[model samples]
Target: MRHAGPKLLTQIAAVHFVSHVHIMLIPALLPVLPGLLGVGFIELGVALAVFNIISALVQAPLGYAVDHYGARRVLKAGLLLGSLSFLLLAASPGYALLLVTMALAGLANGVYHPADYALLAKGIEPGRLGRSFSLHTFAGFLGSAVTPAIFLGIAAVLGTRAALAAGAVFGAAALLLISIPGSGVYRVAEVGNKGCAGPVPATGRVRLFTPMIGVLTVLFILLNLSTSAIEKFSVAALVQGQGLTLTWANTGLTAFLLCSAAGVLCGGALADRTRRHGLVAAMAFALAAALTALVALGVLWDWALVGVLGAIGLLTGIIAPSRDMLVKAAAPPGAEGKTFGLVSTGFNIGGAIGPVVFGWLLDRGLPSGVFVASVVFMVLTVGLTLAQEVFMARKGRGALRYQR
Candidate 1:
């Protein structure tokens, strides 16, 4: 089958990957902050929250601008500001300065999602959206996942702040790369309708696809919460709860990430071809729940528990791209800003909530709580999936009647 404009997908994937790397820089770089600047968890967490809050605040505007304008102008400027923020964040003199830099990074991140999603939703064939988004999100996952190795190596050779400075430099390099000759140039504004480079014909109606987008937004948040908990507690569970060495714990986390990335590709490929995305996404959720419970059960039978937990990572990965596909399919015209921004808000909110809530559970002698909570979150997605189906069915019928 012919792919939907391979060049465009490559362009979007590159930006998506960079956006994720910028997101991952925090947890990777946070430890050095305290040793270098003499701050506490409270201060660090507060700064992190400030960054997220700022991103959340600007996302709506960013999405709106992208809808009105196009991805090229918005993406370039956001990336430039984000790169600057990374540099400033790495070298900030005080905690206050760091927070300000993070806030700017937040704003920068805000500008990418809406226009990017709109482009994919409009330009790519509907049948291929799953695989495309999966590939896109996987690039992001790979970028974020590999950063520690890159950052740590740089830190070992050039010191911590310099290592982070390197990340900023790399980000800026991505910006420059996009500007070169034959780099998939985007028109600032197209001459005749299609609202600027969109694949959809100008006459296509948009209201036919809104409510389903809303349902998936709910799923995005809930599923993100489970993934955030895994990131926060996976290593802790292995090291602290199971008494494995930190190195071993970290190794297990790597295994999980690798498997998860593979799962993303597999799931996206499957969803792109089949109407069973909901079922597949649901099953992934259930598997994640089961594996988390197995860990809580403590029937490890040796390192097998670690192995099974890696599978859980894979399940969430699958769920992620499937969720992305649902949103893309439901992405109506003229509302990319409202829809993508709302979903992104849900994601950021969940990211902020997961660590705090799961940390509390861990502190309170509740190993099972994490597993239980993840299971509950996944179960909730089942309801959201059903709601999406009903909404889509209704929309499809409305379209049929209109056609008749």
Candidate 2:
């Protein structure tokens, strides 16, 4: 059992790493794609939009599928589907074809969260689950971090098509890794689903729609909204509002992202040590909110700004393992897929809405508003986290009294 946990974690993390690589492929190659497809930026933008919309629409339903059909089966299908989409793109480089391929890719993208989380929940030992989740997340972040440089370098030397072909190969390799005998994926799934009969009952389905899940969904949305502001707009804000050089602003953003990844690892250790995930998340967000507000003030030295952003990144990253732990704690048994799926949809929702709002502020020359808005979202998240803790505590007490 102990050996099985680490093996499963390693394989699942590799799968997650490839999943993120696929997600970033389009954005990474955007510069060359317009010219390659003989299309303008608007056409490309529409393709990207199509991808996000399809992903958002299907995520919840897919979560149910993961729970019903088994995570292993659904995940394999997603891997194959996503790989084929990219291979198709490499084969046919036309605007119309791009839209079709991206839509396919989007549906494939929706498969990762529910399937990955479901697998981890069932496979890893309880004591090690927090660290497993963090490592999995860290792998994805590493994928995104490396994609731009690796793919662009490939595109530069071998052309766009070859770069995409490389991604397809990566995905195919991941598929084989999971499918092979002795991978332990099959063993984990069998153990996890033991004693489960046909389909999930209506009662089980109802559990997914509870207020706890809804609040967690909102919490996920706020988390994404807060981070997106800093990630998508902070560099612009710092350069324009804080009078920093473009180089310095980008440097700060890099620090934030790198530290955020480092923080996830540290946060994993913290998560394993404590059950007060909500307190951890709430405190981290509260402190992060304060630091973000400081950035909005635009009064710090350039180096100071970089340091503050790095600090905020560490705080944000620290909350992530705890955030996943909170969701896991709230999830009803046998419903991990649906719960994770439903809450993860919040990422798409926030991703879709956040840019318009922050871009609007930037368009209107309210650069500082970007940081200010992030602060607002972080504060809201803290409130939500605390409220959830209260609710869960009350529910626990009620159950104890009923038992008595």
- Error (Å) of candidate 2 at residue 152 is 0.2
Q: Which stretches of candidate 2 lie over 4 Å from their true place?
A: 1-3, 190-206
Could you tell me every candidate's TM-score relative to the true structure?
A: 0.88, 0.95
Residues 1-404 of candidate 2 have per-residue lDDT tens digits of: 32357778888899999988998999899999988999888888788888888888888888888877788888999999999999998987788988998899999999999899988887788898889889988999889889999999999999999998889999999999999887767666432254643444442445568888899999999999999999889888888887899999998999999999999999999999998899999999999999999999987777888899999999999988999998888777767777888889998899888989998998999999999999999999999999988888888899999999
Which residue pairs clash in candidate 2?
Answer: none
Per residue, candidate 1 scores C-alpha lDDT tens digits across 295-365 of 76666634686688688888888877677666655555555554676677777778777888888888887
**Candidate 1 runs further than 4 Å off:** 1-4, 90-92, 185-211, 242-248, 394-404
For this target, which candidate reaches the highest TM-score against the unseen true structure?
2
Root mean square deviation (Cα) for candidate 2? 2.2
